[model samples]
Target chain A: MNWKEFFKNLKTEEQGCVPDETRREFLKIGLIITGVAAGGSLLNVVSVVAEGLATSEELSKEYPYKPHYSMVFRVDRCIDCERCVEACRQTNNVPEYGWRTKILERVDTKAVDQQRQFMPILCNHCNNPPCVRACPTQATYKDKQTGIVKMASYKCIGCKSCMSACPYDARYFNEEKRAIDKCDFCWESRLSKGMKNTACAEACPAGVRIFGDLSDPNSEVYKIVHQMGKAVWVLKPETGAKPNVFYTIG
Target chain B: MKRIIILASTLILGLSGFVLSEITEEGVKYQESEEAGGLEIIYTKPVKGVLFSHKLHVKELGLPCESCHTAIFEMEAFKSQRNPDFIMDSLYKGKYCGACHNGQTAFASNTKCATCHVGVKGLERLKKKAQVLEKK
Candidate 1:
């Protein structure tokens, strides 16, 4: 049968194939059903497309092909000097008991032979952040433009959910301020300085912390991680936080 | 009839996407056990020798994640060394093996053979299954 005739075979004359009153009733039902289906499909398509576009934009911001900069921490180079920690603490005026950044010491004193090794701990600024998930308010978010995991203190209801949920213990609650505080990657200062920079990284005497864009292959942080032959590691990876901070150990 | 075709195609596409993402997310991880227990030393004249340790470095050292590579390393295809010298140059310049044994951060570059090659005899035997892994 021809294509038109083949399609026409799907309907009976009484089932709206003809222009009679009964046919008109069938036609209306069929048209309404068909229209509803088409409209539903169109709406779904538009919503999915919009979601995909938003996701793409967000991914670009987080995992940019070339960001303005990023951060790298050389775990081996860290001396537990607390210079970076103190710098960040004082610069941001972090709470007395709560630290914005800290040094993680991996002491194997039980070994008896090897000297106690120390690993400084702080926010890894992960690529896939768990802290963002723990927050009920979506207060904790990662900025794609700067690649910084930011905490909206105003939106934060001082819930310690993020603090407890974060494996890195990077989140700290400012009891006095009655809000959550975490690393902002020195974003405000960097913007004012017209370049991406971190106060802790700048104050590091051992040059343990290097901050720049990892997306740009030529950038210092990227080169150090990719080409400079440094052994980079992230902390508490079992938590499944894909951190952006790279630590090179000798 | 048209609806059926659309639904079927959508289901197939969605399933394929999920499967592909799963594979991409959890790619192949090469972990060495005492099963491949022999030591292989690839050498360079006038430079130094490269010692491959199975039990000590990989199984021990207790290296954590992102310690050696970035996050995307888990999701990408492996590139081959186009030239022999390319691989050699990487070792010489400290890209992979040079990353640790450059004589500074990890082990010193010496003509000595036993530095990395000498495995804990008990560890090696246990890896060989001649002895069992001890629960220390």
Candidate 2:
């Protein structure tokens, strides 16, 4: 309607009607609801577009699809050489006492009481990572591209939140750096030219550690994971990290 | 009881529709990525009921797999964007449906709107056409 007509209508309206407080409240509520509905409709479109963009196969492909990289430690082959342990220290240049990676010895004496067997232990990089969610500073991030759980040593305030939160004791507080340091799957080394595998996998003389993409059907790691089946059980499966690292559970 | 049944049916129908749509969207991605020869495939589109012609186009165009299907949708039943609007854009940009439908390489986008967005023209007609073609 024209401004003149609108003004005339306004003037003609019942003047003494101070809409009751209840009515005013109702009107305010109604307006708020209307505003929210309008906003939601626009937001829905944006949300749909955003979701589409995020999941679009095109966008997912931009990050070159490397097979889901993972490591498997065969307990039987691991001689408890501490080679993998020492190699990780020397490679990463970890401090004298500080350890980025270490070997845990598990003794299974129920069946064979005297034969105390040993298995190397470290961070079983979980699939549905818990450490990632607990970090408030996002100091811990699982790489969407590589599926590697990475620790931001610089961003870390040495809160020790991750240390306590880790079920596996895989995380250690770097007293020197004043940050949490943990196994990165030797990402820096693997990413370097001509390095086809992680340091631990490469250093193992027995070829006990088989490393490859778990997703690739053709990959040796994938074949072993599927073929070994029930015999291959991961440590702390109850924790539900869906750890990429599987152990030979004999 | 009737109302409950109706609500339950509605929910079931909604879920089925969602799943069916998702399946179709992924299928489109897979078809688009197929290629042949050395000329890279730049795009692909799975027209409604048409058997996705990945290999056919590859041979016809003498194209490579990456050119048309730039995404990793090389596998069967590739996942499409969840949003219909973005799905529309992907088709337009030669990503999902656009991979093959853009005017330059394939049919123009407008020429094939009903392949996806069926308006008043009744999808039944398209369904009938697809059925008849299948019989042949």
> In terms of DockQ, which candidate is strongest?
1
lDDT of 1 by residue, A1-250 (tens): 1223332443211233344765555444343322343332221111112223332233234344246445666655554446677678777888778887776444333664433343555666766666788789988888756657887777989777877667566777788778888877776545446755677888875566888766555567656554323334444333335566655554
On the 0 to 100 scale, the lDDT of residue A93 in model 1 is: 82
Measured against the true structure, the TM-scores of the candidates, in listed sequence, are 0.47, 0.46
- RMSD, every candidate, angstroms: 25.9, 28.0
Error of 1 at B67 (Å): 41
> For every model in order, what is the number of clashing pairs?
15, 14
List, residue by residue over B1-136, the lDDT tens digit for candidate 1. Answer: 9999999999998886422111112121122343432222222221222224434543566554354445312322222222244243554576655566566767643322233222122123323332122221
Model 2, residue B128: distance off in Å is: 86
Local distance difference test scores for all models: 0.51, 0.52
Scored against the true structure, residue A73 in model 1 reaches a CA lDDT of 64
lDDT of 1 at A168: 64
